[model samples]
Each structure stands twice: as structure tokens, then as C-alpha cells.
Target: MSSEVDKGSSTQRKEGESKRSKPILTRSVSQLAVAEAQHLVLWKKPLSTIYHLVQYMADNFVYLYSEIVRNKIFVFCGIIILIGSYFLDNIEGPHQALFDAVKKNGYWMSYWTFLGFLSSFGFGTGLHTFLLYLGPHIAHVTLAAWTCKSLDFPEPPYPDTIICPTQESAESVVSFWTIFNKVSVEAICWGAGTAIGELPPYFMARTARRSGENLEEEEQSSAKKKVQELVTRFGFFGILLCASIPNPLFDLAGITCGYFLIPFSTFFSATLVGKAGIKMAMQTSFIIIVFTESYLKMVIRLIAGIPKFGAILEPYITDYFEQQRIKLKLGQDSNDGGLVSFLLTCLVTGMIMYFVISTINSLAQQHLIQELKKQSKSESKKDK
Candidate 1:
């Protein structure tokens, strides 16, 4: 009886030891997995990483789609506009005629007619219309003034305007105020669009603050803290100062204002003045001065005098200017509506896609953080 009891006791002890060993091995493997995941080097396997990221986004498509459609109305509208713009560009025949008719007759008559496309270009946080659309328009106007010796105002979708300057107006003076007045409406419209683009960040930050989810000081960078401090100190003037400059950090300003629960009217009014009023005026004045005949000629001379590559570039530059002159004289559209237009459309689409992806990722991260916080609070309460 003693021997049987010893055997059974030994067997039970062995079984317990085996069970404990199994758990230890499992835990070690899991720890190894987590360590490897933490140390994943994306650059070493960029293609694979991209593939996985794309797959993950695809897998979570439904969740992302629902979030955008249900919660992010602004984002939804932006996406629609982007898609619509792409289609509109591709349309043929009647669409082209309709666009031409509007450009010729209805451009200055309706604010929407002028504002619609310019605003779209200025929409979103990163992409500014000044470089792509407005800057070129200013340059074209300046070029026209130099060549035609008139304040030949290039309208929106400019250098492609249906109504061109007449030979009769060739002797007209292209003064500073004349140029400014011609492009003033476009500048205002574009600036207003940019201000509207800024709203998303503000709204997002405000919503987070209202929900009691504030960004911790430790999570913020030093630059961000400084911006917030500046904004907090000066209020309206602070926002105006930040928005007036061509600063990329204006988005941060928007976010900070929202987080502080600044009133919409105050924030918007300040932004509008800074962007549409001050900034536009500065840009317009600068362009007008820079594109004057003597300055433009000086620039062209400098470009032609570049050491080794000058000879090669000089011909292309000369030909381009000559082409512009001929086109202006004939009152023809500079846009060929072929490869260049397609490339531009592709570029804009890519930017919009990148913005959408970034926003979705940010929202997802916030959601996860909120969930984790809730879980910790619940567990602590349970312990109490």
C-alpha cells in the first residue's frame, strides 16, 4: 500500500511540473515574437513593409470607410471634390464648351465661378494654390505686360483665358495698382479657400478637447508647445500673426486654437484677415514688383549666363519665351490638355490620397489611446 501511494504521488508531481514547463515555454516564445515585432526595420524590407501596410488598410477598409462617412463629413466632401475634379478634367466635347463659355462670360460675374476651382486648388492643409495656379497667373500677367505693354490681366485657368487682350490696348500702362486690382479677386478667393481648409484641424482638436481628451505636455514637441503658448498669450493677434506669414506651421495654430476652445467667429475672422487680406496683398505686391520688365530681363540674363549648362538651357528658355509671346499675340490657351494636364491631375490625386490616409491613421490612433485609457481606469476602479 505504501509503494502504490508513493508511485501515485510521484506521478502527480511529474504531471504538475510538465504543465508548468509548457506555460513557461509558451510565454518565452510570445516574448520573442513581441521583441521581433518591436524591432522591425521598415527600410530593410520596404517593399514587404508597404505590401503589409496596404494589406492591413485593405483589411480594415470597412472600419475606415465607416469612420470617414459617419464622423468626418469634411473629409467626405473633400474626397468627393477630388474625385469630381478628376472626372471633370477627363470629360470631352460639351464639357469643354461649357467650361470655355463660363471662363469667357461668367468668370467675374459670379463669385462661385471664380471661387470654385481656385478654392478647390487651395483646399486641404498642405497644397497651396499660390504656387500652382495663382503664381503662374501672376507670372503670365507680368509676361503679358512686358510683351504686350498693357496690364493684360490673365483670368482664372489663365494663360488659357478665352478673352485675351486686344492690340488696341497695347499702349496701355501696366502700373502696380492696375495689376493688383486685376488679380485681387482671385487672391481673395484663394485665400478664403485656404482658411476653409484650415477648419478640419481646428474642428478635430476642438472635438478632442470637448471629449476630455487633451494632448499631454510630454506628447507635444517643443515647437508645438511654444506655438500654443504664443497663441494663448496673444489670442486674436497671435492667430493673425501666425496666419499672415507663409508658414507651414499654421495648421498647428489652427489645432491649438481649437484645443483652447477659442470661439469660431474670432478664430475665423482673424484667419480670414491674415490670409486673404495681409498675405495675399504681400504676395501680389511681391509678384508685381518681381515680374516687372527690367527684373524679368535681369533674371533671364542670369539664367543664360550659368557656366556649363547655360548654352543648353538658353535655347529652351529663349524658345519658351518666344512661344509665350506668339501665344499671347494669337490669344491662345497655353495648356495643351495632354500629358502635362494628366500629370498634374495625378499629382493632385496623390496628395489628396496621402492626406486621407494620414487622417485615417491619426483617428485610429486616437481611438486606440482612448480605449486603453478607459481600460486602465476600469481596472483601477475594480482594484479599489
Candidate 2:
């Protein structure tokens, strides 16, 4: 009897152990399956997003086209511009003359000269004029003074001439005031253009609000929520402060202000002051100090002294400085249709396309809703 009881206990113990071990094995397999699924999802997410985007566009293409056609003025203008551009591209003599005329009249300080740069900067993401056009111009001016050891300002259409000169000696000292005067007009124009760019978001938000569309329920990032809160709390001064400091969240501010039904004049005025007045001045001053002094060069030298990456960075840095020097010496503009220019053109095209598509989608949604409402009302009347 004792032996049988012992055998039974041993058998039960073995069964329990097997049961426990089976769960562990199952759990391990499930964990691996989950991990593999996640990995696949990571790879598939972008492709799925693109596929869905294309599908959505395809579904709404008819509505979008109808909405676009309803706006006859926009369609007419677009067609005219396209036809004009094609013809202008083919005509050589007149085109060359027009180009020469633009080159001559569009000097730095001429509002006309900076128009293209201003518009480009305003209309697109990652295509600021400061980095491409104005920043380089300021650097070249500072370097020219430093290398030439004289205060000889270049003629217009070459290097930009400053408005106010305040040097006592022939030796060039690029003062804060001097740099400020040189790039002020261009900066203001660029600032105004940026302010104008903010209008689309504002208008879209306002239109949605007026159309009884609620965007409040939309999921927002923590950062965007915080920016919207700040804009709402502070109003005009809040917008000015946000705009003045080179904040990327200014778009959120514009959207919030528009959704809350803020006046256009107040929002625009504050933005203009912040971006054109304070922000531009700050940027201009920083560039002047960096290029005029040995700070940037010293930093480059320090980086080049690093172990492995230093050697790689040194050549590129040296080449960049050399190119800048050559450009200044040759008195040529930096829009040489290089890789950077090509990239800028691509970015601008993408931004324009995005804006047009978004606008059309919004209009189409509104039109579709109206049509649905009318159809429902007619059906109810027929039923009655």
C-alpha cells in the first residue's frame, strides 16, 4: 500500500511539472511570434501608408477635380502660367534679355532682387533664403573685408552695397550696424513672405470652423498641444514671442489663432514684427559676428583635430571655405544650378503640390457633405 501511494504522488508531481513546462514553451513561442510581427510591421508601415494615401487620392480624384473646376479663376491662371512658361523657355533672344534685365535690376537691397529668394523661402519647407542666398552674401562681404584689408564695398548686382557706412579708417571692420543696414530690406521681405505663408493654415482652419467641422477631437502631439495652449493664453504678444525666436511650432500658433477666430490684422502684424524685425536682426547679427571674427574657422580647426572623422570633415570644410573665397573673388551669384539648387527646386515643387492637394481635398469634403445633405432632404420629402 505504501509503495502504491508513493508511486501515485510521484506520478502527480511529474504531471504538474510537465503542465508548467508546456506553458513556458508556449509563452516563448508566442513572444517570438509577436516580435516577428512587430519587425514586419516596422518594414510594412511606410509602404502601407503610401498605398493608403494613393488609394485615398484615387477615391477622391473625381470630387477633387470637380471642386478645382468650380474655381474657374485658379484653373485659368494656372493654364495661362503654364502656356506662358513654355513659350518663354523656347524664345532665346527675348529670354536672355529678360534674364539680363532681372540680373541688373535685382541687386541686394532692391526689393525686386530678393523677391525670388523671398518667395522660395516663404513657400517651401527646408528652403530658407538665409542659408542659400542672404547668409552667403553676408559671409562673402565679411570675408572680402577681412582678406582685402580695405572697406571697399562692391557695386550692386555684384556684392550688395550697405545703406549706412560708419567706418573711420580704410581698414574694414564689419560692425553690427553695418551688417544690419545691408541685409535689412531683404530680411523684411523674407519675413513678410513667411507671414504670408502662414495665411493658408489660418484660412483653412477658419473655414473648417465656419463649416461646423470640429478639429478639436483630432489627436495632437504633446509639443503641438503646448504651443496651441501658449498661443491661446497670450494672444498677440504670444504670437510675436513665438515668431521672434525661430520656433518651428509657429504653424501651430497660426492654426490655433485661426480656429479661435483671431483677427487677421492682429495675427499678421504680430508675426511681421516678430519675424522681420526681431528674428532677422538676431540672425543677421550672429552671422556677421561669426564670419567677421575667427570663431567659425577656429571651430572648424578644432573639429578637424578630432581623431578619425576629423580627417574626413577637414577636406570638406576647407573646400567650402575655398569655394566661398573664389565666389567672392569672382563676384558671381551662388545660384549655379548645382545639386543644392536642384534640391531646392524639388522641395519647392513638392511643397506647392502638397498645398494644392490639401486645399482640393478640403474643398471636396465640404462639397460632398453638402450633396449628401441635399440628397437626404429630398428622400425624406418623398417618404413623407
Candidate 3:
């Protein structure tokens, strides 16, 4: 009896060791990865469902003009309506004339409002990209763990010292495209389309607020406001068109193009061709125009990076009241030291600018989140 009990205990110990030995590597998805995955989820979801989600997203993200749709309509309607307005501006010219007339008549307030609307339109739809940091890490952990589980699917001793073949092996071409190559791009394309669809009108409204428009009839001409009614319908169509394509790809291409040189010059032409096919199928001409016309945009962007901007101001810096001018590189001199006061001056100025910009951005983000919370509460009350 003693021998049998001892044998069972030893077997149980070996099984426990086997289970504990399984995990050889642990990893976490970066915020960028999460953002990419979410875009994939959005694109994979049904059109109607995505439309509803956009509606929920937009209301929380923007101070969309009360002048626009009063109904609890889908968010994409705004994008559709914007596109229609663009065409209307092209053909009927009613909306364009009204806008021009407003500007001519010293509607500087309206003009500024229009610019603001353009800047923040897609902000609502893209706000969800924050899910990169805001969401539960559980989903990410699960994906990592699921991959680890599949490490043994080919049957393995999965040696402890050996990096498992599953971890080291080249992922299939499809996986490579979808995982590393596509994620960064998906975020950019989706974000840009969201911006294009959502920004113009909301920006207009916000600009009015920013410019201190306190009166109701300040710019409302009864005949002119009829164009806004069409704006809602057309905006929805535009958003639908944007949402259909891999919107993230457009942005990804632009940004990555700015930062990187590899596989881009070769792949970019092909990418544009793919995007052209996509936009035409969706009947969104704006996208085709964007990718086709923006060849110099990235080179321009590379020139305008933050570090490059710092370098631009370096030449103007001159050392004061000295026998010989001191040439100081960045971070080489302490501000209190006298040898390179000019460099110190520039450094201090740059630091101040960075702080002020960062603070304002933080405030903007906080304001946005607060606005979203208020909207959510209002929506819930209305639903009840």
C-alpha cells in the first residue's frame, strides 16, 4: 500500500512540472498594435453595425452643430453629407456662393468656423484609436497566449534552452502582410478617412465657437440653411465610402512614407493603384485625388520633422561679447555656463515651446474626454 501511494505521488509531481514548463516566452502588444487590430475589427464588422458605432462615436467626440441633423442618425451621415456639399459646391454652387458671400460680407467668424470644422471632423471616429491604451489588456494577453498554445501544434519537445520554432519561424506571407506590414498602415488610412469624412463641418461649428459667435441668427439665411439639410444626407454617404476601403492604409502610407525609405518607393505606386481601385469601387473620388496628387507630401513632411525644425534655428544662434564665437552642439552645454549663451538661449526657448505645446495638447485631450462623458450621459437620458 505504501509503495503504490508513493508511486502515484511521483507521477503527479511529473505532470505538474510538465504544465509549468510550457510557457517559454511572454510578450505584450504595443499601443500601435492594438490600434491596428481595432481597425481590422471595424472593417470586418457589417456596414450597418459600423454605421451605428460611428454614430455613437461621433456624438461623444464632437460638438457637431445643432444646426445639423436633430435626429439620432448614424455618424457616417455627416461624411456623406459633406461629400454631397462638396459636389454641390462644384455644380449647383449654392452652398459655395453662400459661403463666399458670408466671407465677402465680413463673415470672418463663419470663415474661421469653417476652418475649425475641417480640422476636427474625423477626431470623433478616430478617438477610439485611444483604445490602444484605454482598453483591457486581457484581449492582448489572450492573443499572445493563444499563439504560445499553438507553438506545440506541430508536435514538439519545445526544449527549454531552444527558442521554439513557432516563435522564430517566419510567419506565413499572409500573416506577415496582415500583422507587421498592414497594422501601421491600417491606422493611418482609417484615421485619415475618418478625418476627411468627419472634420469639415464640425470644424466649422467649433471655429464659430472659438471666434465667439453668441447669436443665433448671426449667419443664418433661410434660403442658405437649406443646403445644410442636404449636407447631412451627403455626409453619411461620404463616411460610408471612406469606411468601406482600408482607410487606415492611406494614413499609414503617408506617415510611414515620411519616416521610411524601404519598400516604399517600389510599393507606393502599387499601393496607390490598389487605393484607386478601392475608391472607384466605393465611388469616392476624393481618395483617388488625395493619393494621386500627394507625391511630394512625404518629402515635405520629412523636412518638417520636430528635430529638423530644431536644426533650422541653429544657424541664427550667436555667442555674445566674446573673443571667439563658440560652436556648441545640442545638449553639450549647461544653460548656467557662459561659453554658449546663444545655444543656451535657443535650448531654453525650445524647451519652453515643447512644454507649452504638450500642455495645450493635454488640455485638449482632457476637454475631449469630458465632452464625451457629457454626451454619453445625455444619450443615456434620452434613451431612458
Candidate 4:
């Protein structure tokens, strides 16, 4: 009887141990699985999947054509053009007269220039804005280049002359200064215009309140006061940073200031300083590149005359010149003279940050609600 009792006790002890160890073993396996899943999801799998997806899209002709035709208005406009061309060909006499009119007195050029100016004003008014959506630096560079090309300025200042002007090089200095000032001032003026854009919406809101419209006065006032306080605290630095940075958010800042009745002169001064400073920096960089070509090429030639490192460096030096040419062209036409790509990148990153923050806040709110519900249920159960 004693032996049988001891055997039963040992069996019970073994069963208890197995029960405790099962959870540990299961938990360890689960943790390992979770970690492996996370590693696969985080980078390796997602990157490979994205790469394959892009490769597939690039290879699909139908998909590519569909994507191109997705712009309905543009496609419709193309169709209209085709139909219009057919009709015009049938009425060549009238079409010819219209064509001649466009050709005469540089009418076509004047028409396009007028349209450009109109578009610039219409589209560029907002807080974080560019002239016709062309970045400020690119717009300035293109304008400067066009002005120089059109006017045929005598020995129009290249970067080299601008950077290293001497007492004897008065012509180059003057030309450089003139172009720089022109571009810089234009940028400043555009900045001011954007600041002005922030005004109308705020005024309209104020007007609605005054007129006893449906707007909630207390909420509007509270929000406005909060913004005003923040702006007042930051003051000049805030304005200057917004103006200097190439982003659409600047317009909103300008509008806030206007809504709060910040002094126009003060606002203009900050904007002018910020915008002009950025433009001047860009102009200086362009001049420096030109200077480098003239001075660096001479140094490179001297080095090439040397025996050992010259051979290796020659190909590199040639490649550098080639890259500079491409850079100069791309800088003028795309991505705001390539000087302000960082600003554009910042704007995009900022937008993504805002999106992520908003999403996190939403998730946090949901979690809090769930926790509150759980707490209430526990409290009810305890009462029962």
C-alpha cells in the first residue's frame, strides 16, 4: 500500500512538471516564429517583392499604355486636336490666315509669354509656392539665362569671370552683378507675393464671422489665437525659415501672419532677406563652378604634365568636366537648378512625417477606447 501511494505521488508530480514545461516550450517556439516573420516582413521580402513588381510593370506594354491614357483630360484634348486638325485642313484658307496672323509681329511669342505670366500669377500665389510650380532657383536661373541670351549682353558673365573678377575686368563684374541682382530681386518679389497669398482665406473667414454667418466664432477665434501665439513666439526666425525653404507650407505661414495682422513691412523684409539670400547662394555656386572649370582645368593640365599620377587622374578629370556640363544643363531645367533638391526632399519628407503622426494618433485613440471599455467591464463584474 505504501509503495502504491508513492508511485501515485510521483506520477502526479511528473504530470505537474509537464504542464508547466509545455507553456515555456510553446512560448519559445512562438517567439522564434514571430522574430523570423518580422525579419522577413521588415526588409528582405518587401524589397524583393517591390523590385519584382516594378520589373513586371516596366515590362507590360498594355499597362504602360493604360497608365499614359489615364490622364483623361489630356487624352480628350489630344482627340480634340486630331479632330480640329482634320477640320482645319479642310478649311486651309482660313487656317492659313490665322497662322499668318500668329507669325506676324511675333504674335505667337507674345501670346505664349502673356500666358506664362498669367499662369505664374494664378498658380504661384499660395503659401508654399513657386512661379508656375517651377522651383524658385530653376525659375530664376532660366530667367537669367534667357535674359542674357536675349539681350546679348557684351561678354555675358560666365561663372569664371563672376567668381574671379579683377580691377581690369570691370565689364565682367558689372554684367555679373547686374544678372545676380536681377535674379535675386525676382526671387524676393515672388516670396512676397506668396506671403500675400496667405491673406484672402483668413480675411474671408473673418468676414463670415462679422457677417454672422454659420462659422463657429469661439472655435475659429481659439484656433487663430493659438496660431498667433506660436507665430509671435517664433517671430522672425519662423518667417525667414519658411521664406528661405522651398516648400508650399510657407504660404500658410504667410497667411497666418496676415490673419493675425502682422506688420506688412516686417513680413516683406524677412521674406526679401530669406529669398534673396538663397538666390544669391545659388548664383554664387554657379559662378564657382565656372571658376573651377577655368582654374581647375589649368591645375589638371599641370598635373597631367607630371609622370606618375597624371595618367590615372586624366580620365577622372575628363569625366569631371563631362559631369559638370550635364549638371549645368540639368540644374537650369530640372529640380530647381539642382541647388534646391534638398529642399524638395525635405518637403516630401515633412509630408510623410505628418501622415505617419496622424496615423499613430488615430491608432492611439482606438487603443485608449478599447482599454477604457475593458476597464469598465471589469468594474461592472466587480460590482456584480
Candidate 5:
């Protein structure tokens, strides 16, 4: 019995030793996969989602506005911030003063509303794109609300404002042309910006290989393989989808395109096509809904004719049309005035932006998880 127990114990020890002696090379791939997965999860969410979400909230803004108004804490904090900013703007005491500090940290201050116009290149926090969407829809209200009255801007608004031409006006043809022009310009600008954003990562990879900066051939080979895989898997459709969609992952695709030295023509063309599609869709929608009176009337009628909800929604529907009419006439009102209303708008915008961003982040995480699993399997096969 003692001999049998000793033999069994010895066998177990040998088995354990063999397991411990397994090759580290076999594990590295899985480790790398996990690390890449974690990195992707940590970042690469749709930043543009914040803009779209804000627009969506603005589109379906009811409870959201009231909720913001009802929040005493929010109201108090807002008041404090406003009062403090006002004082800071006037005082200008310290070098790192409150308003200056906020500006330094990328928070928009006085005349900050015009920052939207510059956002066509994905430069700012996407407020401008939202403005681009809202401009034609809400006309002057969206513009006036965002612009600072202190600017004493002018009697006439910016020339590029998205207001559709009146039907009775001969300039309607020009306005129609402007719609296509606007979409094309936005697509090219944004697409170029996105492509430019990819250059840093691509150059870094190239520089590393050229300089042999502690980067192993195997690692470089792996990265190249990954890029090649992407190119093979998605090709033009993949590039187009990423560009068209408000996704943060587009940067990765861009980087991959650069790293592989994809023809500049191909990359630019795909991006332009995708972005143009998106902008055209948005612009056309705005034109149809806001500019075309017949279409607007038909839509309102349809909404009013709905069975159960129509009656309940009738007042809101009518009010919206009336508001649009006033907006078209450029009649600014008290409703668009006051710090309170501005604060409410800001609160609603922020809430919607956050919600959209968070949802996209979750989706990005799910995608990353799947990618990790795929990479792990590939790694495992190579090991075998």
C-alpha cells in the first residue's frame, strides 16, 4: 500500500512539472489578444455619438427639458457657474483665472456658440454638426440660441445658414443647389480631416520599423497581418461604413489604411463617398421636412390623423408648425430669451450627448470582446 501511494504521488509531481514547463511562446499570443482587447475597450467609442445623441434629444425633447428644470441641484450648480463666470469675465485677476482656465482646458466661453461652424472638420465636440442638422430644421431659433447676444453679431445672420429658400422666391434654385454644395463640402472636409488623423499612427508604425526602435520583426509582422486581414475582410465596404457611421473606430481603419500604404486615391475616394452619402441623406431630409411646405403640411396632417395618439398630440403638432412658421419669418421671441432657457437647452443637450456616447461605448466594447476571441483562436491555431 505504501509503494502504491508513493508511485501515485510521484506521478502527480511529474505531471505538475510538465505543465509548468509549457512554452511561454504559446501563451504570448493569447496575452497579446487580451491586451489589445482591453486597449480597444478602454477607448475607441463613437465620439460623434455625443453630437447625434444631443440632436436626438433635441428632436424628442419634452420630459428631458422638464426633468432638467426640476432638478434643484442642477439649477443651483448652474446658477453658481453662471454667476462665477460672469464675475470672472469682468474681473480678470489671476493668470489662471476661471474663464481663462476653462478656455485653456477646451471649454468654450464667450462667443463659444460660433465654434459649431468650425466643427465641419471634426474639430470641436460636434456641436457644429448638430447645428448643421438643426439649422434648416429650426432655422433662426437654433442659431440664435447658440450665438451670444453680446457679440452684437449683426442684423443679418451668417451667409451659409441652412435656411431653405422660400417657395415664392426665385432664389429657390440657388438654395436647392446650396443643399448639394453644402453636403459635398462637408463630406470632403470631414473625410480629409479623418484621413489626416490617421497619419500619426501610420507614421509611428513606419518609423518604428525603419528605426528598429526595439520593435521586433514578429510584432511588426503581426500588425501588418492584422491590417491585411482588415483589408481582405471588409475592403471598400468596410472603409465606407466606418466613414459614413458616426463611429470612433474609423480612426483605426484609417490607421490601417495608412500603415498598409493603401493608394491615397482609394482611401480618399471611399471616405468621400461614404461621408457624402451621410451628409446628403441628412441635408435632403432637412430640405424635405423644413423647406418644402407641401411635404410639411402632409406630414402634419398624417400626424394629426393618427388614431389614438393624434388627439393627444394635436396641440403639440400645431404649436410646432406655428413655431416653424414664426422661425421662417425670423421673428425672435421671448421664449428664445433668458438665461434659464439657455441653461435648459444646454442641460438637455449634455444629457442626450452622454446617453448616445455611452450606448456607443458599450457597443464598441462588445465588438472588441468578439475581436479578442477571434484573435485568441487564431493565436491558438498557430501555436498548435
Candidate 6:
């Protein structure tokens, strides 16, 4: 369905004209010729940032594949180890807890509950990345998202669901890769380190651009700036604290303290201890949910007609997306950007991360309301 634009259409110049002028592709003449060519050419863009990167690497494979790997082998190996860390992410007990939360509380209630869960994540990761890395490296992913949006490419992740930063292999981010690998090495050497020290606890902070929230709001330059500054001040010692605190209490204390204070300072300080703990929780929960027997029990309770309390979950999740949409200042909200329609598109595109929200809507918002009617009717009949 996607096509590359042919240079001939936009450029009055032909590739032939350029090749003829300078057969030595390395010469300045070739460079000028190429620039003239792109200026004149009407070409379709690539699908995404990652797509653009992979394409760039593909275009220069002979130069990059070996020497770059050699120069950066230590970092590469550490990144390799980080990728391996995904295997440790399951939490059978927590996974069961999630299921139990869903079943006993109702899918909807559990859904509403995740807002506190997600926002709390932002607090910590912002701190961890800023303090330890001193780079607004989080953009590594957002930039990828922007790149993907520009090109329309799907995410090119490996089969393992553990997220590796999209730009780990980017030609420009060599230092970032090195730093990230350093952290991964530390995690490995120390162990998941008291639940807070665990790397998997947090999922990469979710982006709201996907939900069609305000593009302007989502595009705010300050979010990255705040996180980066926090890093500058605290360094990783600040990070160690972030990697240790529980997210809920951390956020609870933060938001309460923050209402009278500025959002950035509140968020930045909260982040100091928030990022690592938040990520660890998610990673731990994800692992537990997928593997444990308690998971089975949680599922069983739902099937057996237990009244789950998910009344506010759908709206909560939706609001969470909206909140990020506003905070990050993306394109438009669900109301303006045809977000509901676009969300449907995501559903079709196989972004399963949103399924929980979807289930909440279908079951708790619509289905459960009807299910309750059925239960009421059966009860009345038995009473008669």
C-alpha cells in the first residue's frame, strides 16, 4: 500500500544528470546534485523513524554492520543483555492479582484504577532517566513515534515483548547506547535489587499521540526539559532513590504536595524515586499475571458470575489518555481528532496494549450494565 516517490517527478533533474555530472559519488558535486535532486523531486516519505533508521542502515550496511559493532561492542553487548532482561519480567502472583482485581472489582473498576497507576509511572521514570543518564533519552522513543508517524511504518520490535529503546541502534545515539548498557550491567550485577531496584517494574511511559489527543499539548518541549534538569541536579544518586520507592505512595505524597507547588518541580522531585519503582512494578506485575495459578482463580471468579466493580475504569483509562494528550500536547483529543475512530484503527492494527481499556468499555461500560439486567431478571423469576 505504501510507495516510494520517484525523484524524476519532483526534480527537474534526473538521477542520470547527477550521475553524469559526478560519477564519483563521494565528491561535493554529487552532494550538491543530490540536494538539488531532493528539492526538485516529489517523493513519498518512509513509514516511521525506526523505518527511516533501518533504511539508512540498509543503505550503508557495508560501512556500519561491522566497524560500528566493533567500536561499540561493549555497549552493544550490554544492550544485548538489556534485551535479555525481558525474560525476567513475569509476576505470576501479581498477574493473578491483576486478574483478581479485574474479576472481583469488575473489569471497569480495575480500569479506572490504572490512572493512578500510569501517572505514577511518569513520576519515577522521569527521575530515573534524568538522574542517572543526564540525557533526555526518553525522546529516543517519542522521536521514533514521530518518525513512524511521518513515514507510516509499524513498530519493528523483536518477538520478545520487553521494550528496547528504538534508537539503541541508531547511528547517532552511540553514547546513549553506552550509558543505557552501563545501567543494564549494574542491574545484572546487583540483582533486581529490592523490588524498587528492579528494571522490569516499569513499562516505557505510554505515549498519548496514539490516542489523538492534542498534538500541540503533547508536543510540549518542557516535559523533556524538566526530566533532563532533574538528572542534572540529582544524578544517579537521585536515581537510586527513584529505583527504590513504591509508586503509589510516592505519587500520593507528590500530587498532594504538588497542588500548591509547580507541576515541574513536583513532578521532577516525585520522579527522583518514581521511575525505577514504577517500571519495576509494571514489569513485576506483568510477569506475575502471565504465569501464576492465582491468575486462574482470578479468571474463574469472573466466569462464575462474581459481581466485579469496574464502574469507573473505562472513563478513567480514557481520561488517562486524555490527560497525557493534554500534558504532552499531541494532535487532538478523542473528541477533536476523531480519536475514538482512530482508537478503533489502533484496535484493528493489533496494538494489544489497549485491549484492557477496550475490555473495560465493552464489559463494564456496556456489557456489564446489560449483564446486571439479566441477573436481576433471573432473581425476580426465582423469587416468584
**Top lDDT hit:** 1
Tens digit of per-residue lDDT, candidate 2, span 183-216: 5666676666666667766776788689764453
Compute each candidate's TM-score over C-alphas: 0.60, 0.56, 0.19, 0.30, 0.41, 0.22
> Which tens-of-lDDT digit does each residue in 1-384 have in candidate 5?
999999999999999887765434435544564465444422453454344344444544775678777897988899999898777678746744666657643432222223222333221223334443334433333222222211122334432232323234333232333444433433344344444444444444445445433221233445446544665478787676666665444545665665555666677677666754664355444653454455556777787899998777666756654654455445344365334346547876885575444554444443454455556668768988
Full-model lDDT for every candidate: 0.67, 0.63, 0.36, 0.48, 0.49, 0.35
* Candidate ranking (lDDT, best to worst): 1, 2, 5, 4, 3, 6
Clashes of 3: 34
lDDT of 5 at 276: 47
Model 4 residue runs over 4 Å out of place are: 1-170, 173-179, 205-229, 263-269, 276-384
**The candidate that achieves the highest TM-score relative to the unseen native structure:** 1
Specify the poorest-scoring 10-residue window by lDDT in model 2.
34-43
Rank candidates, TM-score, best first. 1, 2, 5, 4, 6, 3
* Candidate 1 clash pair list: none
Candidate 1's TM-score reads 0.60
Relative to the unseen true structure, what is the C-alpha lDDT of residue 109 in candidate 3, on a scale of 0 to 100? 34
User: Model 1 over residues 239-328: C-alpha lDDT tens digits?
Assistant: 998889877677788888899999999899998899888988898888888777778677778888999877777666666666777877
Report the C-alpha lDDT of model 4 over 244-350, residue by residue, as the tens digit: 66554444455566555567676667765665466435544464344333555776688798899787777775664454445443433334323234545677577
Model 3 TM-score? 0.19
Better of 3 and 6 by TM-score: 6
| Of candidates 4 and 1, the better by TM-score | 1
Error of 2 at 75 (Å): 17
The residue pairs in collision within model 4 are 127-251, 128-248, 128-251, 198-255, 331-337
lDDT of 4: 0.48
